[model samples]
Target chain A: MTRQALPPGTLDDTDRQLLNLLQEPLPLTAHPFAAAAAATGLAEDEAVARVARLREVGAITRFGPFLDAAAMGGAFCLCAMAVPPGRFDEVVTLVNAHPEVAHNYERQHRLNMWFVLACERPEGIARTAARIGKETGLKVHLFPKLKEFFIGFRVVA
Target chain B: MKLDATDRRLLAATASGLPLTLRPFAEVGTWLGLPEAEVIARFAALQAAGIVRRIAVAPNHYAVGMVANGMSVWDVADEAAEDLGARIGALGFVSHCYLRPRSLPDWPYNLFAMIHGTSRDEVEAKRQQVAAILGPALRASDILYSTRILKKTGMRLVEGG
Candidate 1:
């Protein structure tokens, strides 16, 4: 029989359970963690302490409301550039220098560098993409979404 | 749906993160010098408007054993794309599924889904699962594994209201 995969980091079963709960929307009340604490069989303070520790230990990156950029009247466009592997890092720095470049990733493909431009307005998308193209001396191919089938982000800890 | 000055301040004040306390909203209220009631009210309103997707832990995928992720793209029949994409998005392993326009010649994919797993093999397995779902409707497909995350700050509100 195959063995179960070990939980990552130093998280115990309780921590894992708490993480699973935390990934979903917390209560919008004054004592948001009260229900979570009760569910995890921990004191409210203890639950808060654990969450703070998780963040400090780098297990959880951020503990806040995930604001939808598009809902906020902002624009986001996916873009890609094919750069010579030799100059990848330099090109990455150039492309990522812009504040509008919200997320950038190096992927395995002919168009190796993939990034998302988050702009204050729809027009800003093209402008930021053009700037990156000019600086990197590469074609910035934009792939805006025609439609989205958003299946919420949830990971079992 | 429109954010007034107060809403902007609330968003900006807690952009980094919400305070972790029994009465965390009160703490955020303190930071912005607003009463706890106002902070709670604003958060409720923002969430109601769908601007705040969720207030929860943004776990590090790598730290949580979800180390492998791939942008799986496909060239699909335009007519079947919407129905098939919705099905793919419903799968637990698929986080983001979208229908995008093809660039042609250089790029021919019009559908994209981000698949995640604990390892590359698992990722590929999930990719196959997606393929099975697409069946004959899928003309071509490719999986782009992320080698590095150059930058990844989720959409932050930059301009002041």
Candidate 2:
């Protein structure tokens, strides 16, 4: 398979390695990027510069520790709803207004609207669902994760 | 460990992202007026406690040419779902695999896996591979292809923040 071209003049070998290294936890030391820089055969300053550039160019969406809502005394649920094509935009506006709604995506199915709701409390999920349903006049189907076998990715950029 | 005022503030500072710097901890420390060692220690402790999953870069999958994304749902035997979920989750192409409750008479899928590829056909091929792996234990399945991403963000549910 042919590899797709990265954005023009965006990422280089060092950036790739740095991105991969960042996918793992950073060492709990004073100079975390130093280890990554050494591993990628780049100076610490250069590694930091490359990462900064990557962030500027949108190659890296976020560069920081990922926290789980559940672990932090919160709740999350995957939800789905069917909206007529005409009302898609309006529904989106209404649903996205909720701070609890973390992600909203349109999928190709009868239940076209799918989103993940994250709240500070487990009961908050159902309450938010009720609010969304009442506001949108559509039944919201909840799909809270019962067991997570795996839930992550490491894209080799 | 329970989060106090300082921890919440720390999380908020880096919620969007931490600065891409050589001494990221030092930078955060300087901004928060805490020592570099203390910043590192707190973050490490949070990670060990499972509050912070990992410090990493989140790539835009679409930019990386992973255009075809499908959320594959499956209805498997109640007793075998856990075993099958583990097997499915282990696949290289499966980014997220979980066992979720079925919506009863309206929806019957209890297992879900997210598959991304270059095209729909590729996703379908991977789905078939999962089918082969599950064999008779898999009762039913469907692939929900994402047509549009209206909005996507890491969870930010800090109360009153």
Report the C-alpha lDDT of model 2 over A50-87, residue by residue, as the tens digit. Answer: 88887766677778888877877778899999898999
Question: In DockQ terms, which candidate is top?
Answer: 2
State each model's C-alpha RMSD to the native. 3.6, 3.1
**Residue by residue across A32-86, what tens digits does model 1's lDDT show?**
9999899999999999999888777667888998887788778899999888999
Residue B104 lDDT, candidate 2, scale 0-100: 77
TM match of model 2 to true structure: 0.89
What DockQ was computed for model 1? 0.53
* TM-score of each model, in listed order: 0.91, 0.89
Q: What is the per-residue lDDT of model 2 for residues B1-161, given as tens digits with 9 covering 90 to 100?
A: 88877787788888877877778898999999999888888898889888898887776655555667799999999999999899998887898999999987778999999997767898899899999999999899999988787887766646643
lDDT of 2 at B75: 95
Regions of candidate 2 where Cα sits further than 4 Å from its true position? A1-5
Candidate with maximal TM-score: 1
Q: What is the lDDT of every predicted structure here?
A: 0.87, 0.84
lDDT top scorer: 1
